[model samples]
Target: MEAFDIAGLCAHPDDAELVMGGTLAREAAAGRKVALVDLTRGESGSRGSPAVRAAEAAEAARVLGASHRESLGLPDSALERTVAHRDVIVSALRRLRPAIVVTQHWDQRHPDHGMASHLVYDACFMSGLRNYRPDLGAAFRPRKVVFATSMTETIEAVPSFVVDITATFETKMRAIRAFASQFSPAAGETVALPFERFQESVELTARRQGQRIGVTFGEGFVTREPVEIDDLLALRGRSI
Candidate 1:
């Protein structure tokens, strides 16, 4: 059997890192294979060009030790959950054949976030069907699928799993910092809330989730289906 563990799907260049970089770093440190697939290049982002974004993504992936990272060239905010979109994602899944697929929450402050979540969810299911978009070649279903935490406060998502990432927290910061074009305070670059501000947000989110599960840092994931556990006690050191 193949050993690839996770494929993180996100809408923009840094979305995956922003949401679950700490967890990803922890997984990679444990020798788990992790790949990042960005639905769009963040081409329409308020800051940085496509080339810069691509470079930043590569740098971040290197820091996180991701097995693979690629962008689908999908329209930034104009992405549609269409057959074309589904086919591309399905094809990617068939190629990666990961054990678990991670994506964004269904509802979010940004339209692309919600659309990307729907697209990834539908594509994962469709990738398992034999008759859907046969031109993409073969279909392979993932063992588990989970969505990342969103930035909005109004949405409710009960996490089915959580990864304690306290040890790799600094590595996650390094990965986020590698996106210099976006976070760097260059004169021509777009004004973000400062790199430190963004990092603080990440720190707060991780600490809040970690507190619930008695950890120093963590990343939460909500499963689309019910999670079956062989032993609930195995979760004693983990989170719900």
Candidate 2:
């Protein structure tokens, strides 16, 4: 199994880039292996085909400096908490052996996003069961799991930590813009996304989140329990 410092598993191709590209870039820039795993091809999306999305995802991964990217070949917009779903993630966890895993928050307007959250969480637990799914790879689990909170209308996540992304914000934007098919469709596309000035919205949100931590840009993340801290002097988010 190839060991990785960070692994991101999300519902769709652009999900990882949208939520945690900066954190991934920071880790990769520091010589840590980062991997991205998508649960679906997003074939049901109003804009872009699966092939186009896959191409864009590859480019985004390159932009973010990720070491590996792959999809689990699950049905888009129809994710469920099933043994089969858990099995695939368990196998990937065993193979990748990532120390930390990042995923979307459970509270979401998009049903698939919420389902993906539950699926990933359960899969992480199942992966550690010694006898669970013996046909898959050996039992393995990530040391930590964190949920990313985006600038969405339906969610109000209180972040446990905020990653200062001032340096990597541009890289993250470039990664997101790689999906031209989704953001720049031709005439008569009629996409459902309210993509008007999405770039500005994203930037503004980052700036606001950054202000919370006295930074220029940031990305917020949440965890179910308290984070373990060894050194009280090592905290960075406090505004001094």
Point to the candidate with the largest lDDT.
2
TM-score of 1: 0.92
Alpha carbon RMSD to native, model 1: 2.4
lDDT of 1 by residue, 91-179 (tens): 88888888888898887888899899999999889999988777776778888888887354557566777778889888888888877
Top candidate (TM-score):
2
In candidate 2 the C-alpha lDDT for residue 61 amounts to 97
**Reference-based TM-score, model 2:** 0.95
Cα displacement (angstroms), candidate 1, residue 16, comes to 0.6
- Compose the digit string of candidate 2's lDDT tens values, residues 1-240: 598899999999998888898889988998989999999999997778899999999999999999999999999988988888877888889889899999999998888899889999998888888898777888888989999986555966878899999999999999999987888767776655556678888888788778888899999999998988999998765666
Q: Residue 59 of candidate 2: its Cα lDDT?
A: 95
